[model samples]
Target: MATRQLLLRRAAAAAAAPRGRRGYGSTAEYLHRSIVPTMHYQRSLPRLPIPKLEDTIRRYLNAQKPLLNDDQFRKTEELAHRFEKGIGRQLHEQLVAQDNQNKHTSYITGPWFEMYLKAREPVVLNFNAFMSFHPDPKSEYNDQLIRATNMTVSAIRFMKTFRAGYLEPEVFHLNPKKSDTELFKKLIRFVPSSLSWFGAYMVNAYPLDMSQYFRLFNSTRLPKLNGDELYTDEKAKHLLVLRNGNFYVFDVIDRDGNMLKPSEIQAHLKYILSDNSPVPAFPLGYLSSENRDTWALLRKNLLDNGNEEALQKVDSAIFCLSLDDFPVKNLVHLSHTMLHGDGANRWYDKSFNLIITKDGTAGINFEHSWGDGVAVLRFLNEVFKDSIGEPAVSPLSQPASVDSSRAVQKLDFTLNDALKAGITKAKQNFDTTVETLTVDMIQFQKGGKDLLKQKKVSPDAVAQLAFQMAFLRQYNQTVATYESCSTAAFKHGRTEAIRPASIHTKKCSEAFVKEPSKHSTEELQKMIVECSKYHGCLTKEAAMGQGFDRHLFGLRYLALSKAEDLPATKRASSNRGGDLCQSKAKLLKRAGTPA
Candidate 1:
């Protein structure tokens, strides 16, 4: 029935947008009301004033321009657009500070732990909430207050440390222990609402040591940023092209400013990268899991020296297994260096990271969940240009979109809901189709049969198709049909809407069975493109110009359909569903849908 419906009715495209969605008014009205509700305070964080911050950044850039004298350091305006739109130095705390608050940590809100516990289940990405961070700093609360404050401060501090070009460990390592009794207490009191299955601390946190930091000799001085310096201006022009050079990313943490182990961070990264967003079999809070051994170590390290040392020790320059340091990075050190943990993220508040392996081998994982990849790359190129140390050949320009208030809508639906639905839909769709083809950054342009002939087709499309269809085909032998796993994938590794629809049990049913019939590659491509266009266009149309707010949208639809919510004049309409299903079957037949 689900497959028949997909083949006949274009869910998104065919539906005309209803009236009164956000941003339907004049652009001014949209901007006026659209400013994310959180930024009202940041409209005035006095320290590191905009002009002063800009002046400092400009000066810093001037100093590094000579390093890249060989390469023409052209700060193009177009580059800025890309940065603001998708790439740029992003300050997570600013945003987090606005809305990171929420209900206090307890058993009721345990679902929130999904923020850092993405290791349990594979998640289907949803690009719809382009840059959706969890409840802002104010959305909910627990120990996040102190942690988030420190996170923001640490980010700024990190920039300063970077500009200074060095860090010396201020704290040393310390060991801490937790018992099973604590775990029981957590499970009894604070299991997540969404995933009530896990026990406590499925993964453990180990100790952090101080011997892992670096020291600069009397010779070369590296350029970093200042703790007092703001990465951008009040106007946010720096978001355009990183305001000169050097990419920056800030983590939005708890108010208590608790930091996770490097191994945990790496594990977190990989877990997010994997599609099966599994949840821990254990409870996730501090008291929940037995995995807090590393907490004491982190506390001592940061307590003694500050996050400055913590920044340098992030398994970047040194190989942890060989070097023997704090924050074990076994998770990211792939069996071979061909690591695929590039773009996975757990969107809780504004804690973004840039995991870049220097030279893709230097062990330095560069990540920019805030600025993300594209912006990080531009910053890296700028830094490389700056390393050569040359004056700018061209002037810097304005950023792409200073105000992200409405570039994408803040849908009410959670990533979990999207994951559940997307996987199911994609799988069913795949089973109904003959094949799929995808194009991405990995250009398969080699003409020689020696290389090209060896491969059957591009790996990306193959993976997307296999993952989607296979997941659905394996999930449901009977019902749970939602066969379209639409994921929100960012371009150039940046944030974008991904809503992969698969049959729920999104990835269990054998939804990808090859049809008895076959279609040529050209015909398949047209079908896929049309489907993609339908997805991109209809999403907007349904939300009016303002876009779908998942929470609001879901609530409204559910309310209308709920029997209790029906009007007094309205009695139940029996067999309405059966009629619709019958109509759908007829429509698919008319449309020449394959069995």
Candidate 2:
């Protein structure tokens, strides 16, 4: 009891500090201000432009050249030229026409969503991604219950701020002192919402599209036979908690739409934490890790068994807070735990799962179809700043004197024989799938971002070069590599692929790996500089929506949609022609390589 009192006192002291002074002081102050509305720049952001067909063809050929032999390249080039002058030109025109009709959103948005939702594979490691939080500096604050409570309060605060249009606008500041300052905020706040993007632009700042922000809360990916659907319900005020494979929910918002007091929230989370329920015989969460079609059928069976209310509660809640029972043993273990877990305690369909381990290590595993990392990263930065700076629940805070057992409801499903069998199969499948996967880490302690900045080279480009060198040293060959670059400066933008493998990288890797003594130091250095310059150019092109991948994707999608309308010969020729061309090019390249 004395220990408990001391803890509470410490928490209170931590909570009393001004919210912006704890961590990232200057950033916190810049981001938490409500001067610019969250969606103020949405109307003025540019649309993702459709690259010209000839330009896309040129970029595609360049990207493929590094992986192809001379003969193979010529053949692939011929096919590309044929496509460009014939069916590809028609597809490009149609795609542009379609884009013209859909002026409100980017050309890539619908197709990208479709690409994800139509995939039948399980989402665990395939479609979902995890980003772990750095642990709190205060050892006492890392207590599971205290961390959960504080994170919950901070999340609610973010939601309230965002919905009220006060959440800081997502911006890339070219000149922080000039653009991310009080004077800039004061001037920008008076600009009309529609023109606020231009106003920011004038100050050397670019505001990003926040259209995906709405799905950050109260959203879930509902599986279907053909394709999945994204569902969001902002009115839901409940918080879902998964513990020991059991599902529990309680209201975290009051009738007035305000978040519950920190003490009250802590009380309810503590109640859930203290409940010693045994892991279920057939944990329903495992089903969410199954293939989309399989999960869809099982979900139908569940609904037929009169579990609609239970499923709805799971889906409509404002994000999931997974209370893991085991401590993270190491970095690899923590990554695996947060990425997929045992598949029994994870609701993989949720927009994002806020997973907290028994030792209070926390991270988020988010569903990818509804949004991208940009939106999630912003939420993470804000939540981390808020919780660390102005934690609502500290170790010294006491739980409210309320009967939490009555407030929290444990959701129970009426599972039949088929559902139980399905759950067993899903668990086995998940285990088998994860068993084949591996995660490894390497640290370059000698140099990092600061050193790279001092060297005047792109950090990401150098990192890509390292990967190319490593692969060449291991396999004596270079392979096509992909790096994602966000196109979020445009309205409803998605990601564009930045092809990291280039002829320059290939030459540089060869110089370093084939025979170090043969090349002069200056020659190797020049090769590295060339690779970095080309990589930087690729990165810029992709960010500005001039990359070839999306353009080719759009063209192919249009081709498939209009397949039946085309002449039989054209349709047959267009069907996987590009893929066949690339495959044969790779085969020929391999044949030409020395053993």
Candidate 3:
């Protein structure tokens, strides 16, 4: 009991605590048996708190000091002080009242939503965040059909775990429940609606709000596109398969939720490969590969005609399966094919798009807006463990049973001459865009996170510092750097930007780069450790919803609120201040979001 109380105290002081300090306590006591219905703990989770205006102002000013020149920083400092004392105070009170009124939602949720949807121009999946699986070697070098069959069976079994309520809740490293900050230790129950991992999911790849997802369970591909119209036979259990700029629907599941045998799935694929009549005529999926505004306009045009039904068939699917034309044996190349695809080969807008290569390689192209890496990663780990770690049968072995009751369905679209022309243009645009991207894969075999443990340094901080140090060595100067830390420790949490390239990090990197012979190994290690410790503190604080970026967001929000109530002259002045805050906030956004 006393030990538990001690841990609680440590957690409370963690946010504002001094850096480079250790031996706080063990996390063993924080572990407890979670109750049933893992998601039941959500509504009861504590709301994310708003930091004090004074504290935010101070932290923002300090973070800026290292990044800004003398004159720019002084001007910013004066404005910050004035804003805090004058309009900023009023805004803080309003924010407090807003927080009080919004008992369920996070304080930053509304502002973040606008930024996520309306504020950002391009679609997020391709540009912001995505993940691709490494290719399965046996599948890549051998039988493609049999490998995909094994993969599908494994995936179904994994999904069954989620449906069975046997999935364990995720634990936060920090025990916020014991601290002053309210946080749920078991995060599975507290995921926000935006990041919820259950039930059927979809990804809208088109920037213009085109809903396109191929349901993986209990659906069949429709035959014939009659005048821009699409129809799917709901009774046929098939998965939508896209390959070589063509779409085919093949059965993988039955009506009673039973998975088809591997032989049955393989046979279906064989039939698909033999069919040559489905000309890759209209690369309709290629429209999604265009620029955000372009896709939006094109999607609008499609919807204006009688294309909503056709779009819905693709939009409401469980997931998409893409059979790629590439037969590469290399892992990175296979991963790239699965992730981005040759542009035209993917719908690019599904919550999950599983890619299978001709040589039997397989990987998933996942959309990021659905959930964080934690859930998806856990899902993939389970899939690989079932399929590869302990296979029911070797992918090389043929299945004993083959369900030949169903035939593979081809989805045909009815398109006008103009729509056909649009498809051609989209394919060209996709090719042009893909040609501009440069992909580099690096493998470091020496040491990884373990090296950080050996140094007693945080890996995140050290990795970030390594980049800044690299830039210093190569370019001889430090640039603003941003590292994202997960706030999933809190209810409905997303991410917080941690400015890892701080004042101390700059000093350490400069010392090493400018005068390598000056500092001894001991001295350099000590400095590096200090920087890492500071970064760890900032990350913890941000997870507790006390980071400078969100605080700045709140302050700017308040400023906007107050400006509306002011006269024209005062409003203009307030607008100018708001503009400055926005500009300053952009500097906080840097290049260190972990994939």
Candidate 4:
């Protein structure tokens, strides 16, 4: 009894002791810990400030001056004045109130969301972006086993770094203030969420819902009648491999949810390669590559026929790993694979569709709605850099001889004659579209930003001007040009459109088209200098979120919101066609999409 009581007291004492102190001998030792874990800085991040109304209006008018004729400009300027004093002021006030009341991530969140999420079309290449990696020169594309294993290991390592809160926050322009707005971190989280059944993450409980995360590691997007829906199976512990137009599912994780050994991952790849199967009558997956509404209708037909169970296997898998038989020779060619793979082999909606070619080259086709290029680039950069730095350390034993005990199942569909015809039509449409689109890859062997610096011209502006010149040469005309500028320096901010086609750019483009050698070197250089300066200024304004687009967008929405509150008859009879609302509308319409 005495010994039992002593043991109980010892256990109690240990339980009561503080964990840090128990392990440390000094104050520094006890208190010293990770100062900034991966997401630690998120809470302390400051909110994006609202830009003044007058500043935005003035900037908006300036951007339009280059696009509109004198009479048109006059009408726009008059409207701007009225808008500033009338409904514009009221709307700005409301936006300020709304922003202050809820303190939402950004003042323009409502407008941005409306534009991004409420669009009628599917958010593929038009809204989404893709990127490809430099192929591994060390190996042939046929060495899929080694290449895939490297990619898997690199990705796993990147995730582990993120989980440990060590992933570096993206810094822009070497400004500490800019670093305070770490939207890139949010992008990383967004990717996993989009993949994981559209799950939401609470900030405090981050890395929240491990089951949801595990599902994301094995999730895909399903085609819906409207938009796309994410499907993540908590029970799925593997990736779906697509080769020769056939689908195979296998494990990449153990029962405890840990990623399996690299050798095991490679073995799975080998099995998929060694095995062969007959191609289906039609590549049904190609339907997703068609128009959004078409995919929607087809999906309805699919679900109505009780093929949901079979489709679930495709949708619930983490992502499609396409084993292409073609070689990816360069960045441009690899880019093509990432943007539009063999339409038949790709499940385009997956957030992370990895395409590996027969040459052992690889690229990623990411679904865009989740985040922007910068976010994915950061993740890819880490993986690529890590892969290069770390030597390929293979395990001694080869997974105890390819464990085929995984729940490997082939996704089979019962396609009727109607579905087959639909697929055939989809293929034709896809082919026509592919043929119409021309992607020219240019590699400037010598001149780059350094040359631009020496010539005292902004690289971005020069590029935009080059496009203008090229367009004029091709079509014998000029069109309104746009350049996207990041507003990510603000909290939850996205982007703003900077209209690069100014009077100076137009004059320069016309001069080049009319007679390339007529203008002396000095005269051409002067024109380029002016265009560069103009572009740099506008781009700066956009980054500050004082860009005309978001501000004008806020006011318009605010006016609409107020109109919505009134009776339908009152809203209809309010003379919206008159001067009051016309200016804002006309100005915005002329500028095109502000985003």
Candidate 5:
């Protein structure tokens, strides 16, 4: 009785102890961890602040100045001021009140999601973004089956670590030797989850919001009329594989929620890769690339035709992995293949697709509505590191002896005449769309990050400047340019637009393009430095969530919601076309101008 009591007491104490004190045991640690859990900073992370209306107005005008002439600027300034003093103030207050009531998330979260969901354009090139991975150093590891197996095992490991909250928290370490040290981790483990962010902050490290990490696995963007929806099924344990326009699914995780053996997974993937299934005459994957509304309609048809189970399998899989049969000839070919492949062998609706070509060129093409590149890039970095450092499958590793033909299940759709025709139309539409797009690459071997750092200029700023100069030289005029800056440091934060076409850029571009011989090297260098400094400032402001775009967007959205409550005259004036003309006429009449 005494021995049993002692063992029980020890078990209870271990359970009560912090996760950092507990043993990770046999699980492979892909990422180094602090003492705190991955989501320890989520509750304490600051909310995205709504910029003051005046500050927003100032920033808006500053961003607009370079793009407009004197007359255009004057008219824009008048309209901006009028709106700010009128309905904008009320809308801003309302937005603030709304933001206050919803303290758990940023004010822009819902509207930002709505913006993406409500867009009518196809997701292929419009909404999905792709990033290619640099090939593995060993040529043998680049074999399609070997690479796919390794990535699959690595992906499941990531999902397990992330779901169990064992993965390292995403943090920007300004001073790594101090903040990223074991001493920092030991001290931080004592801090409460609520106050953990402050602890990290004191050490000059900023932890990013990990809310989007949930959508990184078992998530899909579902098509709907008017607006789409994001669906995630955390309970699903299957892995969806697309090859030669065919769909195959196999359990990567067992019923006990433990990952399947690496050998078993490799066998299943190898079986699917070897399966010489003929491509579907009307490949239904193309439907995902169609307009959202059309796809929604066709999706209903698919359900009616008894494809709900198959569709659900596709949607609920951990993530889609595509195995391409053809090799990419060059970087452009790789880009084209990864971006919007033949469309038959790709499922564009999944949160992300891990695509591997015949030459083992791998990249991720992800749907945009669920999350930003921050989450995807983190996953990519971790997976790349983990797969390379301790790969579950190697060149010499052989598949399990078990019959994988029984383990992997091929999904088939029951297509009606209408469904078949819809798919055909979708294929044609996808082809037409992709044909209009072109992929090009340029390798600037002369100077890159190291060179720019040596010159004490931001590499990104230099790249942006190059684009501005190239455009000016080509088109003989500067155009509005946008660069995305992430606001992921705040809870549920999205992104802010950084207007890169500043006055500094204009002057520098002109100096380089319009009259290069007229300016001395030192003078031109000074102008470039000025552009870089201003660009850096813009980037910082946008990342800090002080940009004007989202603020103005919120105000406009609020105003539209309250449009009916406005006075009849104001409502009429706020609209476009005839009402705008009538409002202008009334203003002219008030000013004693001829009607």
Candidate 6:
């Protein structure tokens, strides 16, 4: 009891205590479990296969019980549930085997709607950390109905469809070519009204080694939901639930039929389970959507549900982070340094971190899923070059054969000890290499600003301005572009590739080539304002439409526009660290590299 008290005390101090709730049932109470820091130990599962996309996804969800609660947080226009003044707002079929004429749908959902009705609202924050802006914050490139790129929106839809800890199961559909834009949007629709987000989990790619602390989730205590069907209406709001109960909710993709609920139930174990869990449970710890006070209530009432939350197994995801906090420890500080590193530190670091820094605003209002470290870096690079007269583009890479796409697919390796060790070693070695040459900071900006300045300021200048603040103002470093105001962010057409299927380098290529360098900063800033008119995620619709896929597409296709020809500079320097991960390390180690 004393130990528990001590832990609680520590958690209390972790973030500021909320004004109202205090104990077990308080609005911002802490859960019993400690948040598993995002750091991975990585010693275990050395032999486990580096997970494929689907496996990695499942493993991630299995560890996070009730996975729809992904890394998604919302800053509602108003704190009131119905939006006090009320402003703007606002699927089916597969007859594979039975009932060709009239197909019946069924469900077996808990009384979530009633629960939602019970919501006492000034406003409640539904911050799900697991939601990814899949295809990206920009989705125009994919089939609008979501058949093309594996973007973020559809993943959330899959969760709402089953609610059985739904994950992005690898779906393979023939990618037929189509030019009818209207037909493209038809494939990606989801009834938002039908799906209600449970909670959130800011997702991170688990490292291979640390997966052991969660191996019990592999083939463990998952309940089978069988193949239950979800029913919804026009607006997509969830109305009711039906139950088919034929399939187990936690069973593996090919393994759901492999086992049945154990007939020999142990009375003692059942007693223990029941004793621990409270029926009619709520998502422990209250939050007024997007409020920092949410952190205060994170450590209470966490349930194991007995499986890896990543969905690798049924009824067995190992719970890592419970509330708003990232699960890892001291590394959070390090992770923060890497993820939210401002100034120069921000330039050379990246991590899938959960710390929330201002989005050029006052406090925490973002879902890590919106744009984690990698996405931010990509956004920054684009912003930087755009700030110059260079065109806002990432070079596209050569397309790989479909089979190879799966073969060498990038893995979200866990940030375990081994990888950490590898980074540490690399950093040491890297420090001994790179040479630095000083460039005038203000001069660089003046030069870049003179290059941009010819566009409408409508909405996106705000976000681009946020990105711009980093270099122009924050870095105190010089960029070649200077606009009167920073352009805000918006979702642009994902039409970077002339061919939807092929990859395109983001810079120095034909697809979305970098702009040619200009003679003055003024011209650079004008191009940026013009570019901002076209891109940057300024609105919810715009933010939801884009994803990291555009960036991914670029990495794979290896094409680029001329202005972002940083690789050439590196090549001229005989350097070897232009890659995102290594580039910063190279920059950090700039002082020691041999000429």
- TM-scores of the models, in the given order? 0.26, 0.90, 0.75, 0.78, 0.91, 0.21
Provide the lDDT at 474 for model 6. 46
TM for candidate 5 is: 0.91
lDDT of 3 by residue, 424-518 (tens): 88778667666766777788898899988897998878888889899989987776666655555445555566777788888899888898799
Looking at candidate 6, the ten consecutive residues that score lowest on lDDT are: 238-247
Could you arrange the candidates by TM-score from highest to lowest?
5, 2, 4, 3, 1, 6
Query: Can you tell me which runs of candidate 4 are displaced by over 4 Å?
Result: 1-35, 122-124, 137-142, 164-166, 171-236, 329-333, 391-400, 405-407, 416-421, 515-519, 556-583, 589-595
TM-score of 3: 0.75
After best superposition, candidate 6 residue 481: deviation in angstroms?
11
Q: Check candidate 2 and list the clashing pairs.
A: 7-395, 7-396, 8-396, 9-396, 11-396
Candidate 6: where is the Cα deviation over 4 Å?
1-456, 476-595
Candidate 1 C-alpha lDDT tens digits along 201-305: 122211111110111000111111110100211111110000011112222122343332222222222222222323322111111011122322322333344
User: Each prediction's Cα lDDT score?
Assistant: 0.23, 0.82, 0.56, 0.60, 0.81, 0.20
Off by over 4 Å in 5: 1-34, 566-595
lDDT of 6 by residue, 1-595 (tens): 6543232223212111111111111111111111122111111111101112222222222212211223311211111112112110100011112113322211100121222222222111221222111222232322211211111111112222222222111111122243112343233222121111100100111111111111111112111122111111122211010011010111111133211111111111112222322211121111112122221122111112221231231112111111111222233333332222221111011111112211110011122211222222222222222212221111221222233222221111123343344334433332332112111222244324323433344333433444444443344322222111100111111111011111111111111123345324575445444435433222221122122222222221221222243353233334332444233223212211111
Model 4, TM vs. native: 0.78
Q: Write the per-residue lDDT of candidate 4 for residues 425-510, one digit (tens) a residue.
A: 98887776666656778788889989999988888899999998998899876667676655544345656667787788888988
Per-residue alpha-carbon lDDT of candidate 5 for residues 283-386, written as tens digits (9 for 90 to 100): 97899999999999999999988999999999999999999998989999988988999999999999999999998899999999999888888788767766
| Candidate 3 weakest lDDT stretch, 10 residues | 202-211
Candidate 2 Cα RMSD after full superposition onto the native fold (Å): 9.2
When sorted by lDDT, best at the front, the candidate numbers are 2, 5, 4, 3, 1, 6
lDDT of 4: 0.60
lDDT of 5: 0.81
